[model samples]
Target: MEYNLEVAELEKKYSNFHLKHINIKLPKGKIIGLVGENGSGKTTTIKSILNLIKYDKGNIKIFGKNTNNLTKIDREKIGVVLDDSFFAPILNVNDINKLMKKFYHNWNEKYYFEKVKKFNIPTNKPLKEFSSGMKMKIKVLCALAHEPKLLILDEPTNGLDPIFRYEIVDLFADFVSNKENSILMTTHITSDLEHLVDEVIFILQGNIILDIAKNKIDNEYGIIEILPENISKIKKEDYLKCLKYKNIYYILVDSRLEFQKKYPKLEIRKPTLEEIMLILVKGE
Candidate 1:
């Protein structure tokens, strides 16, 4: 399968923090969710890929071209949306549209304004006066107007209302429908991507702890609730991770189908994205 983005042996260090050998693959036509705590290397890894920051080692390739060698066309095909945009605070939405049009060869001026109007964004006011939600909407409008082949987003829906959130998710699904586009996003709201994401990459304390396919997440892994005493009967190898709450123990099992055969008395159910993160992050 062709990959939209690839990272290998990526490394960076700071006085108190280090991101080591971070490797990632974003397959074309899929949405890959980057999951981790606030201080984890999600942003750091993304920054290194975008060359927004200098990395000590490794390489990033977007559209099969090394980031360092990205041509104007290649760069233009990749869209980026960050939580806090670096656009001049004095610039209004109209100014932003004009500026981006100069750089984006595929910029659709009509589509851009249509999106702005659809989202009910004010066109005349300076960006500095807009709320966080409004700012993010403008970023989305810009990213989608150019019809980018790949989207790299950081909390693109951070402050959007539920209706807009659903709209954005559906838009992502539609973008990849052409089977030539993909998305890599880091978000605190895992539930939003529970149904939309094709892959999940879990980073912890600057290290990638889990990278699992979305289908495997749904059909294989599960939350197993059983008495702590029954835990020993379940093979030690079967436990991916486990946590205790009150009298019940939540076990993240490698395969729910197999576990059910071994312990029919236990209760096994599908785990949400948040529950999986909790067990993997905090459980023993």
Candidate 2:
């Protein structure tokens, strides 16, 4: 019932893009995955929540305090891993630690060093010398060094290998086990989310189209494959969305059990997060 982050009627407008009436409620100890296409305003919504940009309307609360009013201490409780934001390329791992120590009161030097060693990141090489995956690891480690209560990450696993991605995901699982911490992350990798997130939010063209528990998607939602010619056989209320490609039609239904009972001959299979997003975004 308690939420770590809440957004109501959030709106932002640009010359060519608009984020409209965005609302999100991230409860304590839960991981929420945000998914959308490349230009779907994911970054814009995050920036708005962090008060990094001006919004035309809406209220954002982090730890029950307005984002606009968060003091330095309040901000310290949140960790952020933005895709394009980090230390200067010239800073090495040691230099980054030294710099961050001066910025955060709770910076855990021992923990940070331990993770750096575990991740096998080089201490002497500048960030520019690290590979993209290595850079991502350093950013994630830095975000975790301060023991933040809420993590806001933008593609934190973007450049990691499967092995490291699994490790990072495990770390996230451990982080939220306390039930006082939470995470809001946006990733193109829906497969990771399928096993990691407690809930998922789907955004399309700057609008939040779906926000549901991951289990609901796994247990209740289903996809039905049928020939286009048989589409008329399905009642409109039975399916949430439908798409046609080549010779087949893919229909998404929220009540898979009932739908299956209604049309026993129809092929109904559980929907993955990616499949659900595809249908919601492109299906009619």
lDDT of 2 at 33: 96
Best by TM-score: 2
- Each candidate's number of clashing pairs is 0, 0
Model 2 TM-score is 0.96
Q: Write model 1 residue lDDT over 1-284, tens digit each, in one string.
A: 99999999898998888998788898888999999878889889889988999999998999999999998889888889888656988999999999988989899999999888988999999989988888888888888889799999988889988898998888888989898899999987898889899999888888889999989999998888888787777776777898887878889986989888877887888888888888889898
> How far off is residue 284 in model 2, in Å?
1.6
Residue 268, model 2: Cα distance from true site in angstroms: 1.6
Model 1 ranges off by over 4 Å: 227-235
Give one digit per residue, the lDDT tens place, for model 2 in 1-284. 99999989999999999999888899999999999888898899889988889999999999999998999999999999998888889999999999999999999999999999999999999999999999999999888999999999998889899999999999999999999999999987888898889999999888999999999988899998898779999999889999887778999999889998999998899988888888888999
The alpha-carbon deviation from the true structure for residue 93 of candidate 2, after best TM-score superposition, in angstroms, is: 0.7
